[model samples]
Target: MSRLARLGLAVTLLFALAAPVRAQVKDDTPRNYGVGRVATPGQIAGWDIDVRPDGRGAPPGRGSVKDGEKVYLDKCAACHGEFGESAGRWPQLAQGKGTLASHDPVKTVGSYFPYLSSVFDYIRRSMPFGDAESLSNDELYAVTAYVLNLNDIVDDKFVLSKETWSRVKMPNQGGFFDDDREKTEKAFWNSNPCMKDCREPVKITGHAQAVDVTPDEKTQKRGVE
Candidate 1:
């Protein structure tokens, strides 16, 4: 071979020989990052506040509906209103029963939520809006109980605890059902979906401007001016 051809072959051979060495170095590199230590049991417990539908993760506490009313008035009344009827644009928590079938369905704690555990979990984790997780265990139970009372799910004399949580039946509990689409729709499902030319060429059917949802340039300019 000529000198130029021989030099090119040598350069190629050099790279081919070094590839295995580079792979070996990468293989010998340590896998352990050695940055974060294993979290302590106490640390894990602090963050493990998620309550299951079966009431598995709920903490031990009890609060009477009467006591819950006081707690609700102090912490929740400003936003949810004194009787859970809502204040201004805030959500209405109680008395939305039989409204789900209406044109404008009122989806509240009583009318739509399926599980009582969900209410407890939400209030315990995040409630009182700006001041979240500030309620004590007793206060948390009380507030939740009071909300249940407002919804007429539980009586005024009822005390909410982990034991009594199962007894508190929400009105719309029967409205929800487990998703069985996997089993039910398996026969209808297409295993291999079409990737190309799935339908006819695109056509402009309509514009969003026709719906008047989007503000026109003139309206935006007027607001700015």
Candidate 2:
């Protein structure tokens, strides 16, 4: 074959290869990562680990407060004291039942958490801090039951599981209200301007440096000021 024809064939082959490279260089568009294919039961079961406020995602296992107490002694008492009082810098998990609006509020699970599902989710995801996901479903339920019992929320024989999880009510459930962001945004946006006429001239009504430090005993002896 002629050299010209050979060069033309080689150029054609290079163009063919470059076509795919050009296609690959296009900008990345957004993709729906979880759109296709209905997840199998096993796959859904593996990642559906979120516990909802209504105890929607609780697993199939039962644990009583008694069982939870044993589990707490073995796995949790080192950090969260024997009765969930907290050992040192760790948080106290119990004994703060009715102090939400106090000047010094001591928030515990019984006093603060609005949902029992949140407590179970937190313990199942990250508790005992160092070890994560080390407890069985039954053990998690037991520990949660024990903690609730310690906080004087649940009865000693209360068993926690997916079926009974939603029935466990918290004390602070009615303390919070829905977000009123529309009113808040309108107030901030429509408020009057305060650039220069915000306040009156500063006045020094009192000064700690000019206070009289002399004893009042001589005034008492005189019986008059």
Error of 2 at 5 (Å): 23
lDDT of each: 0.89, 0.87
What lDDT, from 0 to 1, does candidate 1 have? 0.89
| Model 2 misplaced regions, further than 4 Å | 1-39, 184-186, 201-225
lDDT (tens digit, per residue) of candidate 1 on 99-193: 89999899889999889888989998889798888999899999899999999888889999999988988788789778999998887788888
Q: For candidate 2, write residues 5-123 as lDDT tens digits.
A: 99999999999988755444665888777868987999998877888897878888999999999999999998889988889988889987667778888788888888898789999
lDDT for position 134 in model 1: 91
Q: By summed lDDT, which 10 consecutive residues of candidate 1 come out lowest?
A: 21-30
Clashes, model 2:
0
Question: lDDT, candidate 2, residue 5?
Answer: 98
